[model samples]
Target: MNQEFKKYQAQTSPHPLGLEISHAKGSYIYDIENNAHLDFVAGVSATPLGHNHPKVIEAIKTQLNKYMHVMVYGEYVQKPAVELAKLLAENLPEPLEQTYLTNSGTEAIEGALKLAKRATGRSEIISAKNAYHGNTMGSMSVMGYEERKQAFRPLLPNVKFITFNNFEDLTNITTKTAAVILETIQGGAGFIFPQKNYLEAVRKRCNEVDALLILDEIQPGFGRTGKLFGFQHYNCIPDILVTGKALGGGMPIGAFTASKALMVLLQENPKLGHITTFGGHPVIAASALATLKEITETNLIYKTLEKEKLFRKLLVHPLIQEIRGKGLMLALIMENADITNQLILRCKDQCLILFWLLFEPKAVRITPPLTITVQEIEQGCQLILSVLNQIKS
Candidate 1:
């Protein structure tokens, strides 16, 4: 299976941590060899409720028996999709009432960008440097990292980059700007949180310039940040919000939400601004609806901060320079890239799962499933500390 994966599958990296999985439950993934690997990355923050969560799986099964994809979105008014959208609107702030669902986060981002341009009648879009939204053309164009995007030149035109949290850079957003998109919490840039009302200031500046503010909550949404969305921690409300990753529980989905008036632009003038055949498939929407219900009905979101505190208390070592971010979306910044790499590799061998940040090589990602228990947290932290001690000594 490993050889076949290497031979047939197109990979993103030359070296992939190819774990041949047999099954997964809750916070653990089992390999074909029957070794149970305790999951800490939660499928890179996609499996919010954990692998094959019973509630999400049951919802998918129930929907499968009734129907799957009846028709393209907005034509059929599927119950799951409607309920999910209505729930989202209820949870989100004002002006973010309607939703456009897509297959993935990048696609949702593409739709959001188009909506911004359509509503504002402007072409120039601004994003932060060291930000990771998604991998599609429009999202790639806004990506701050040049090394990864250099080969794919001539991306969407007029897209600009700004330093996140830099007050001076706020001057660049002007009347001509269509939208200013930013990750609520900078993910690939080592889980950097907004500094001192920076997001609120940006909201004010965009309002002054009459430009739309798009917040990409792809990695930090759905109770990952102790709140339903990371932007909730700060007081900044975006005009268009792009969401995915954990939105569908364990299923693949993404969505962009804006006011009904703004989203209607996608259906007017040009007509059919963006369309996906499988955007809001009924089964996926059912899974997402169950996931959202679980998050809201229970105290899972509130416990993320308590879990975060426990992790901080346990993961103290000299090799670790800092632990950045809030709630479950965290990164452990080691002194050097080599040390970080060694810790991650060693932990994998020890039957504990650990991962890395995209742009920051010296940082280790620790976005575990929100359902992880205190015992699991202690076990994972002990394994990590053991590896760090070996590297140091």
Candidate 2:
């Protein structure tokens, strides 16, 4: 199977953590040999309620039995899609009522950028340095890391970048800028958080210039950050809010929300300015609706901060320089890139899954599912400490 994967499938990284899966349930993934590899990454923060939660599965099955995709998005009145958007509006702040769904987060980013340019009549977009939005052309154009994006050059023009959490950079977001796209909490750049009211200040600056603020809550949204959205914690709301990953439970979906007025502009001036056939697929929307209901209704969202505290308490070690991020969205900053690599690879061998952050070579990702138990937290931390001890010895 491994040989077949390498031969047939197009590879992203040269070395892939090829774990042959039998099935996954709750916090553990069993291999073909039935070795239960504890999942720490939660499919890179996509599965918030853990793998195969009953509610999400039931919703998907119910929707599948009733109907699948009958028509392209916006043409038909899909019950699941409509309900999901309505529920999302109920939870989000004002002026962020209407939603446009897409196939993936990157696609959503593309749509948001286009909407910003169209609404403001400006072509310039600004992003944060070391940020990872997505791999599509528009998202990649706003990506701050030039080394990763330079190969895919001739990207969308009039894109600029500023340092994340830097107040000085807010000045760059002037009237010429259409939108300032930023992660609610920086995900790939070691889960960096907004500092000293930086997000608030950015909101003020964008307001003064009449530029839209697009917050990419792709990784930190959907209850991972002890809030339905990470921007809630910072006391700042974006003009356009983009979400994906955990929004669909274990399924795939993405969406961007703005005022009904702003979103309607996409319809008339360009006549289907941004359209997607499978944007609001019934089955996927059902899954997302279930996921959102579970997170918002239960105490799972509130428990994330408690779980984060437990992780910090158990993960103290000499090699772990610091733990960055809030709630379950976290990164362990190691002393060096070599140590980070060693820790991740060694933990994988020991049947405890850990991963790395993009563009942050010295950081180890620890974004486990929000539904992870106290016992699971202890078990994973013990395994992490054991591996760190081995590395030290």
lDDT against the true structure, per candidate, is 0.94, 0.94
Error at 359, model 1, angstroms: 0.2
Per-residue alpha-carbon lDDT of model 1 for 229-292, expressed as tens digits?
9999999999999999899898999999999999989997898889999998999999999999
TM-score of 1: 0.99
Cα distance off (Å), candidate 1, residue 28: 0.2
Q: Which stretches of candidate 2 lie over 4 Å from their true place?
A: none
Which is the leading candidate under lDDT? 1
Clashes of each: 0, 0
Quote the lDDT for 280 in model 2: 94
- TM-scores, all candidates, are 0.99, 0.99
Model 2 deviation from native, Cα RMSD in Å: 0.7
Writing each residue's lDDT as its tens digit, candidate 2 over 1-393 gives: 999999999999899999999999999999989999989999999999899999999999999999998999899999999999999999999989999989899999999999999999999999999888999998999998999998889999898999988888888999999999999888888888998999999999999999999999999999888889999998799999999999999899999999998998999888999998999999999999999999999999999999999999999999999999889998999999999999999999989999999989999999899999999999999999999999999
